[model samples]
Target: MTIREITDLVQGEVLCGEERAGDEVACVFASDLMSDVLTLKDVDNLMLLTGLCNLQSVRTCEMSDINYMLVVRGKEVTEDMLELAEDNDMVIVRTKYSMFKTSGILYAAGLPPVY
Candidate 1:
């Protein structure tokens, strides 16, 4: 799915990388654990959905080559986090839905899980 489609499906607000809205995502990885995120390698076009609103999460995304991140449960995204994501050219989307609900919506919309 495209980032634009995912944003609409999750009712998300783009916090950064608006130019990347047309990027295609191959799958979704929803987790708040940075360790779990670290285990993923060389998996291209991944979109991360997490409730962890921190710089580490942004760092994790950069290292994991995740182009898009959808923050769930209406968490507050700090300016530092936004700046870091922008530096990495990662697209960040904020959604009002819970992690589970956000995942479900994406799944129902044909976004496969990383598994």
Candidate 2:
């Protein structure tokens, strides 16, 4: 699915990278542990949904080659995280839904699991 489709489906707020909304996302991965995400080897073109409100999450997304980062559970992302995402050329979105709920919504919309 495209990032625009995801944003429309989840009603998420686009915090940054508005120009990247047309990007395509083939899968989704939900995780709070940056270490776990870093250990994965085939995460390209995936959207990362996490409640971890830290710069590390952005780092993980960058290293994993994830195109999108969706922050769930009403968590606010720091300026550093936004900067990291911008530097990495990734889109950042925020949602008020819980992690499980957000994942479910995306899954139901045909976003397959990364694993």
Candidate 3:
């Protein structure tokens, strides 16, 4: 699904990367644990739905080559995180929904699980 569709599905705010809203993703990985993200292979075009709104999350996405990150639970998106994400060319979205609900919304919209 496209990032635009994801935002519509989860009622998310495009904190940044609005230009990338047209980008398409085939799978989703919902997690707050950066370590778990590191374990995955072939993460190209994957989108991350996480509640862990920190620099570590940005760093993890950088290292793993994940292209998108949706900060769930209405968590604050710090300037530092946005800066890092911008530097890394990552699309960052913010949502008020809980991780479970956000994942479900996207899943019901046809976003597949990374597993």
lDDT of each: 0.90, 0.85, 0.92
Best by TM-score: 3
Q: List the residue pairs that clash in candidate 1.
A: none
* Model 3 error, position 27 (Å): 0.3
lDDT for model 2: 0.85
Structural similarity to truth (TM-score) of each candidate: 0.96, 0.94, 0.97
Local lDDT at 86 for model 2: 90
Q: Write the per-residue lDDT of candidate 3 for residues 1-115, one digit (tens) a residue.
A: 8999899889898998889999999899999889999999979899999999999999999999998999998998899999999998889999999999998889888889988
Ranked candidates, highest TM-score first: 3, 1, 2
Tens digit of per-residue lDDT, candidate 2, span 31-106: 8988888877787787888999897788878777886888987788888888888988889988888888888899
Q: What TM-score should be assigned to candidate 1? A: 0.96
TM-score of 2: 0.94
What are the root-mean-square deviations of the candidates from the true structure over C-alphas?
0.9, 1.1, 0.6
